[model samples]
Target: MRFTWAQRLTIAAAIAVAPMSAAHAWNESGHRIVARIAWDELTRPQQVFASELLVRHPRFAEDFAARMPPDIAARAADDPERQRWVFMHAAIWPDLLKAEGKRLSERIAALPAGAEKTELERRLADVKRYDNATWHYDNKPILIDPYALPPAAPPGAKPIGVQQALPNALRELDDRNLPAERRAVALAWVLHLLGDSHQPLHAVSLFSARHLPQGDLGGNVFFVVKPRPADPTPVRLHAVWDDMLGTDPKLEAATKRQIVAAFPRSRLKQELAEPADPPAVEAMVNLWLDESYRAADTSVYDANLRAALLAPLPAGATSALPVALDRRYLPAALPVARRRAALAGYRLADCIRRAESRSRP
Candidate 1:
């Protein structure tokens, strides 16, 4: 049976690999960088506003892994069908941004003539705040996909113009009636939307009943490696990428040193200084995501699978899918999740550097 991308994605999860709880630790690393940069650039009030926004919508910091409904996973396992093109609509982040933008435009149009100038200034400040703060969430890490979205298509078909969604969302904000802070929220969401849109599994669907019943639940339920040695519990796929990657204190520190050593402060600063314009940030995030997925498939995933296969079976293993848990598979799969998360972070930082540079006058 020719397994579709969805199947491959799920199968990677089904295998007992890592613990889910710690699978997404790497997420904090990226969010921290973005938050730090935003804090440095904005006014105290603006900083407060950005902080509140992030607090209100913490999902922006990490993939909403646990929130994924069980139904999403059951459907994939039971049917095992390829996902329809429509399922891949730019992730919910972009839609949220579009909604927020409309709200902002509404606020803008209601300004009185006497207040228009002040209002526009406030609105522009809000825009800059977002433009500055959202680089990491919205535009960092360019996605380099071999399969880019198509331009025009049917309602349920995969839309190629996904990249255009954010800019359009921003334009809508430019036309809305949102309060300044709310406008900031909208822009922040737009930043985050770009990141979510680039995550490959976000655009995929899976078989419903052949093996596992649930769909991928945006990959939250699909299990992957957890970095620790003793705890061989399986973690969901989304969580793996969301946090785990190089997040293990030992692993994260080691990886951080390597990235720093290889890229030096000068290089890191230059990379972070890349453009943060709506169009540029969006394009860059897409490019990074594409590259990360490519790496995940070849270097990361392949290595994990090999490790799982090679690890000796624990004491009594009956079936290929053993009731008594497999040791080798668990240890091996754990690293794949960690590696992918690291790559995602790496690409994210790369995109942010480019966006940051672009943001500079």
Candidate 2:
């Protein structure tokens, strides 16, 4: 059966499930697909080493193993697919920590004065320490859209962003001198942060003459709606792209392969060079940021989206009326997202393999 362009756009947006509270991109499905792709690139021995680090994570049993869906849990302990699922789970652990922290808060709230509440409070404190909220994105301001725009106020101090944290995460994974426990934590972070680094919105904030003079806060304030939903509720453009790969809650093996195969390194030859010895850590991260910034300039802030966003705001509101994404936006945007995600996966695999900690089989 044939579908209209509008229908196709709606289909594209509908893949997103409920929006996450975090404005970061590459929602759970995206991160998991990146991890899946990286996992497939690893040899069996490498996979074993990575999986062992995940096992050593402080919350591995509580947050990972116990949370496995029944289908995965039913597999034999040595099943390769099940182990792959662990990698997928590890990739989303940071976001999962957010929800877990929220649950702990609510559970503590409901509990009366007792040892149980005290222990829960301690666990919540631990979650607070473990969560690094600022590391997901680094906004490079786009000061000029079509017309000259006023400069955004200088941020007094540099905000810690993924660009800074990612290299540290890599250093952590590669620093074999660190205890296994610390390496385990870094492994989870690297799995998640690399995928975030590739998202275009995560790399930029648009400063335009009209409604977004202060910048669009990395598209968090860039409101959009699905073409057909005609639903008036405004959704963040950042959240829309977060689910670009699709949003099934669980990552089955078949689904994983489909997403990985959709965007391979061959498709990104122009966007990225063949893997080489990574330069200094900071330089490597800057290269990733450059790819995302370029993606944001062409694909994200394209003519259609800019026109919609720059139009007048609602009479009494700060944001423009939510712009309906047309067929044109998704066509260019989805491919960029897929290509970046696939490259992230491939590059992440390279990082794991070359890390000083990688042991021979």
Best by TM-score: 2
lDDT of 1 by residue, 1-361 (tens): 1223454445454544432211111254433332222233344443333333333433333222233345643444222111110011112333333344556677667776666757665654544433321222211121123232222324785333334554454443343354444443444444444444434444332222322233333344444534345344445555545553334433544554454444444543543344555344455546555544454444333444334333455455321111122345445544444333333334433433333333334
Q: Report the lDDT of model 2 for residue 290.
A: 87
lDDT of every model, 2 decimals: 0.38, 0.78
Residue 194 of model 1: what lDDT?
Answer: 41
Q: Please, what are the lDDT tens digits per residue for candidate 2 over residues 1-361?
A: 1234454445335424323223567888888888988999898878888887777888888888889999999998668888888988889999888888989999999999999999999999988877878788888888655763646456797667799999999899988788888888998899999998899888888877766665667887666766664554556788778978888755545655765677666766665564467478788888998889999988888777777666665455444435677767776777778788888998888888877345442
TM-score between candidate 1 and the true structure:
0.39
lDDT score, residue 10, model 2? 51
Alpha carbon lDDT at 290, candidate 1: 56
How close is every model to the real structure, measured as TM-score? 0.39, 0.84
